[model samples]
Target: MLVDSHCHLDFPDFAEELDAVVDRARQAGVGRMVTICTYLSRFDRILAVAERYDDVLCSLGVHPHQAAEEIGGVTVERLVELSRHPKVIGLGETGLDYFYDKSPRDIQQECFRRHIRASVETGLPLIIHTRDADDDTMRIVREEAAGQPVKGLLHCFSSGRQLAEDALDFGFSLSLSGIVTFKKSEELRDIVRDVPLDRILVETDAPYLAPVPFRGKRNEPAYVAHTAACVAEVKGVDAAELARRTTENFFRLFDRADPSRQAAA
Candidate 1:
């Protein structure tokens, strides 16, 4: 079965039809999903969604865009505390996002580092989101790795080859989103072609970045299959094999969400 390793099921876009959306995902063969948290203030909403669905899990984080606004309230201790919940499996969709620069670069960097520290302490994988700040992102991740081994997934990856190479070098998995399926994403497809199959995961980043045939439309976990199919083509593997590997990679990185663990529990 496939897993939408990253999504935002708590967002209002899905509030009206969350059950249907999840059902459609199951119908499309997606067995699990991880709903991401962007703001510490909205974490209750994220947690509520995860708690409601057995197949859904959540992450605790402050998106780079909200770093400044939430910086005062987001501490490594607090992140670690919230992550103690069974449904909270990862940390931060957090990193640098120079493209928006909604938060000051320094604050974003500080927040990212704090989240990294929390991940180190809790042993939970980080769900990183970097955009137009590859150099800074790489530098921070590399610096943090020097202190302790850092492990995580680069969620909705749509960055340069250098960042991709650096992430893999640091033993972080790269998650593919529908962005890789766009007609103009040849460069991204090329990057995927070169990335090792074992280091790959697939996501929908739902309510955003829908794949072709569904492009410009509201995306959902069900659409991860399209991204998987595209990546399979790039990797020269069968679609089913790609799904199996990515799902396996997802569990390997986000072990808290592993089905085997749940079964044992």
Candidate 2:
């Protein structure tokens, strides 16, 4: 079985045929998925998706791009409180995004730190979304995790090798998205080859980056298999083996997700 470790099912792209979309994922061997919440205010919608699907889980927290808007609202206490829901398995698709800078750099950093604290407190793995801010992201993760156990994954990892190495050293997992299957992602495929199979996860970040053979089309959890196949090829492993390893890694990182639940489904 395969798990799409991070996605946004609450997004409107799948609103019309949500059930069919999920069925397609299951048919494609994607037995599980974690629908990430980018906006805390819209978390109820995310939770509804998880509640509606037997194999789907959800996270709580805001993305860095909306840091300014959710400043006082996206608190560690609030995140921890919402995470009490059995279906809520992780925290934050939160991290720095210097490429867009939709929010001030300081706000983004502060928001990220808050989410880290929530992850540390709740024992829920953090689903980080970092872009064009590797130095700050690494520094903050290191600083926050200092002398304490912090669990998290760098979701949709498209950062530098140093960041990948640093995240691994920090006992964090790296999640590959459909971006890895692109023709120009040869360097990324090289990075995948170096990543320990036990520390890798796969995602589609659906309604966005779709894998090759389906690139430029609307993405969904079903396309995660394509990304996994590509990564498996690069790592010289059978696609099934890669799927098993990644599914194991996903369960390891997001401990709240009961593996038996997927089996029951």
lDDT of each: 0.92, 0.90
Each candidate's clash count: 0, 0
Show model 1 residue runs off by greater than 4 Å: none
Worst 10 residues of 2 by lDDT: 256-265
For residues 1-265, write the lDDT of model 1, one tens digit per residue: 9999889998889989999999999999999999999999999999999999989999999999999999999898999999999999899899999999999999999999999989999999989999999889979987776768778988889998999998898889999999999999999999999999999999999999999889999999999999999999999999999988988888989888887997998
Model 1's TM-score against the true structure: 0.98
TM-score of each: 0.98, 0.97
Deviating ranges (above 4 Å) for candidate 2: 260-265
Best by TM-score: 1
Quote the positional error of residue 63 for candidate 2 in Å.
Answer: 0.4
